[model samples]
Target: MKQKIVIKVNIHCQKCRSKAMEIAAVADGVISVAIEGKEQDQVVVIGDGVDSACLVKRLRKKVGYAYLVTVEEVKPKEEKKEEKKEEKKGEKPTCQPQCHGYPYFVHYETVDEPNPSICSIM
Candidate 1:
């Protein structure tokens, strides 16, 4: 059974990211480890029968605070791509939105809390 596990960790620096990757790579049943996210805080591990709890624990002990975010069983990439291609073959390409002498803007009140409003001027 193949599994994809995502873990969120409080990674602060390059060294921390390196250590986190190393720790995740050595864990039992981990086939591959990839660091994701802009902050390099999300660890994506894909393998067969990977132990999520144990991997999280090891990361916490070796590379600071870490927690499991998600675990999903996914089909092989080739199968997924083939399915996507078949689906796309029947779909028409959509055109990009065009702005015709109009101002478009989004306003957010707070950084921590996202309250977005779109404003348009013609």
Candidate 2:
């Protein structure tokens, strides 16, 4: 048996809360989930031998959140989420393209533009 850990996460509503709970429950040794705060983002999970880092990552990915941290390290989920939301306001995604859009090239320079000389060859 492993010690129960408290993790603070950012969810959205009841649907999100339920979805998060369902995801966590599917983990290897998750026991139960209890979410605090009004925003439905604060969650506490009791489990044994569960990986905190992975859990946080999955929760963030599933809930469409940017910041996920331990409830102990950062108390009051509202403040942390607000800070994250504020931080996100100024930082836009980098101008790089993802592999999903274009399989041939990893970036726009190689994929988005066509070669002028190569046009004759085609």
Candidate 3:
């Protein structure tokens, strides 16, 4: 049976909302999702047999966002490192021939103190 789940998520801006949408859209059994209630941001996930716990876990791991419950839970230590890795990818990574089939970039080398790290854009 399908269900409407209103999760108290920390959806701050349009970008965040979009990321949440992306995560929810790909999740199994998720028919639809939307961020509603401007006064109170509510992420509505509509799906059949959606595993709320697992869905929340994937959201934080894959999207780099927190799933706000009664109170914010400390993100698992391992996930914190994963988030940092994703951020580094954004800073220094570019398309390599191997990445043609995927939406990813090749990470070259890192810079030493000061000068901004450079990466060839695709």
| Per-model RMSD to reference | 18.4, 16.0, 18.4
Per-model CA lDDT versus the true structure: 0.80, 0.61, 0.63
> Candidate 2 on 12-118: residue-level lDDT in tens?
56788788778667666565777765665666777666666677777777876634444332233345554542345675454331222435645545456555456
Residues 3-121 of candidate 1 have per-residue lDDT tens digits of: 99999998998999999999878766667899898777999999887778888887888888888999999687555544543344664454322223468799878566377566576
Least lDDT summed over 10 consecutive residues: which range in candidate 1?
92-101
What's the lDDT for residue 66 in model 1? 89
Best by TM-score: 1
Give the deviation of candidate 2 from the true structure as CA RMSD. Answer: 16.0
User: For this target, which candidate reaches the highest lDDT against the unseen true structure?
Assistant: 1
Which stretches of model 1 miss by more than 4 angstroms?
77-122
Q: For model 2, which pairs clash?
A: 11-41
Residue 65's C-alpha lDDT in candidate 1? 87
Provide backbone clash counts, one per model.
0, 1, 0
For model 3, residues 17-98, the per-residue Cα lDDT tens digits are 7877787776666667877776445677877766667667766775565564431222334455445423344543432222
Tell me the RMSD of model 3 versus the true structure. 18.4
> What TM-score does each of the candidates earn?
0.61, 0.49, 0.49
Point out the higher-scoring one by TM-score: 1 or 3.
1
Ranking by lDDT: 1, 3, 2
